[model samples]
Target: MDFDLTILGSASATPMLGRHHTAQVLAVGRKQYLIDCGESTQERLIEQKIRFSRTDCIFISHLHGDHFFGLFGLLGTLHLQGRTEPLRLFGPAGLDEVLTTQLRCSGTPLSFDVQFTCVDTTQHQQVYEDAAVTVNTLPMRHRIPCCGYLFREKPGRRRLVKDLLPTGLVPEQLQALTRGEDLRDDVGHVWLRHLDVTEPPPAPRSYAYCSDTVFTESLADLVRGVDLLYHESTFLHEMLERAVQTGHSTARQAGQLARLAGAKQLLIGHFSSRYRDLEPLLEEARREFADTNLALEGLTVGL
Candidate 1:
């Protein structure tokens, strides 16, 4: 299965030269889940050739305009395009009201059902789950009630050892063996030993996202040991005090968080518009975590 993250936009507060806002898509297997819908998200999706029908779920980290202002536009486009599948939206309080008001004022009811789940930004809990993965909320310290998201892929079934299995084994028995379940014949004689017939499943993969929040050491444990981590770095280390006051993180602080969490790789984005060249910010983050990478628009990272 293809597990990767594609960046649509990676700017902070406002769009600039080559950067838009904060938007990303997490593709797992054949499905795609949008993380945030910043400005021109629909255009970005079209530009990237991502089908609107594939995104069944959307996770908004916060109410900040830079993080989710483009959500309504995308939904409207989807409605116009004749999408009938239900969409599951997870976000902080008042999101439903915002979207509803816009739709109501425009007198355009959606063709699809929208299921909204209000998230409690103060708690850590599993908010959504499917056969392939589970999503949890990550509490964050910010100007408002905001939270991040953690995506964990489910463990797969054990692999079968076909060479050792007898040729006459039925499909049902073979399925049991592959699932690591012991199989027996009608007389209760052991037909297959699960351990001997199959190898253990691969470990689950995980990804964490943190955006528009102040730097906090406690977050290290919340996103510990993830395969990939995408965190916001809206300013340079020189503006640490300003970053704290604005409820934002500096590049160096983002790197520190990844290092403390022991993440395999760190992705830094949400750059302040003040920066024309982000080389300094990248250098600052790499000083603390060598595996750090920049979150540029259209960049895709495999997990």
Candidate 2:
């Protein structure tokens, strides 16, 4: 199975000529999960050649306009395209009410169902699960109730050594071996051991998305050992005071958190429009975490 992430927008608060707002697509196999649909996200998705109908879920970190304002337009476009599949949405408590009111005011009846799940921003808990992946909420320190999302791939079945298997083994016995179970005879005598016939599966991969949040050491514990960590870096260290005052993080802080969490790779974005050149921010983060990368529009990273 292939796991990848595509950056749609990276600007924070305001949209610029070259940069848009915050939005990303995490693709696990054929299923696509949209995170933070900021303004013009649908346009970005189209630019990336990702189908709107392929989105399996949408996750909004908070009610901030720069994070969720694009959702309304995306929903309306889906309806116009005559989509009938239900879309699962996870976000803060007031999201459902806001969405409902918007549709009502616009007099636009959706062609598909929107299944909303309110996320508790204060608790770290499992919010979604399927055969391929599991999603958990990571509490964040923001001006409003906000949370990050952690996505982890499920471990696959052990690989079978076909040449080592016995000739008379039944289908059920082979299945048991793939599941790392010992095969036994009707009399309960062990005939084959899983360890002898199978190799361990590939280790699961994990990605954590930390939206607008203040510098907090405690966040490292929640995303410890993550394969990829995408943290919002709204300003450089020179504007650290402004970052703290607005409950936003600096690029240096994002790097520090990634280093403390032992993350394999760090993606820093959600940049403030004040800086025209982003190389300085990248340099600031790389001082703490060498594997840091900038989240640019239409850039896709594989995990």
- Model 1 spans > 4 angstroms off: none
Each prediction's RMSD over C-alphas, in Å, is: 1.2, 1.2
lDDT of 2 at 113: 96
Worst 10 residues of 1 by lDDT: 161-170
Q: Write the per-residue lDDT of candidate 2 for residues 103-180, one digit (tens) a residue.
A: 999999899999999999999999999888999999989999999999999999999998887798888878889899
* TM-score of model 2 vs. true structure: 0.97
lDDT of 1 by residue, 25-107 (tens): 99999888899899899889888898868889999999989888999999998899899999999999999999999999999
Question: What lDDT would each prediction earn against the true structure?
Answer: 0.91, 0.94
With a 3 Å backbone cut-off (N, CA, C), the pairs that clash in candidate 2 are none
Listed per model in order, the count of residue pairs whose N, CA or C atoms clash below 3 Å is 0, 0
Worst 10 residues of 2 by lDDT: 165-174
Error of 1 at 127 (Å): 0.6
Q: What are the TM-scores, per candidate, against the unseen true structure?
A: 0.97, 0.97
In candidate 2, stretches whose alpha carbon ends up further than 4 angstroms from where it belongs are: 168-171
Reference-based TM-score, model 1: 0.97
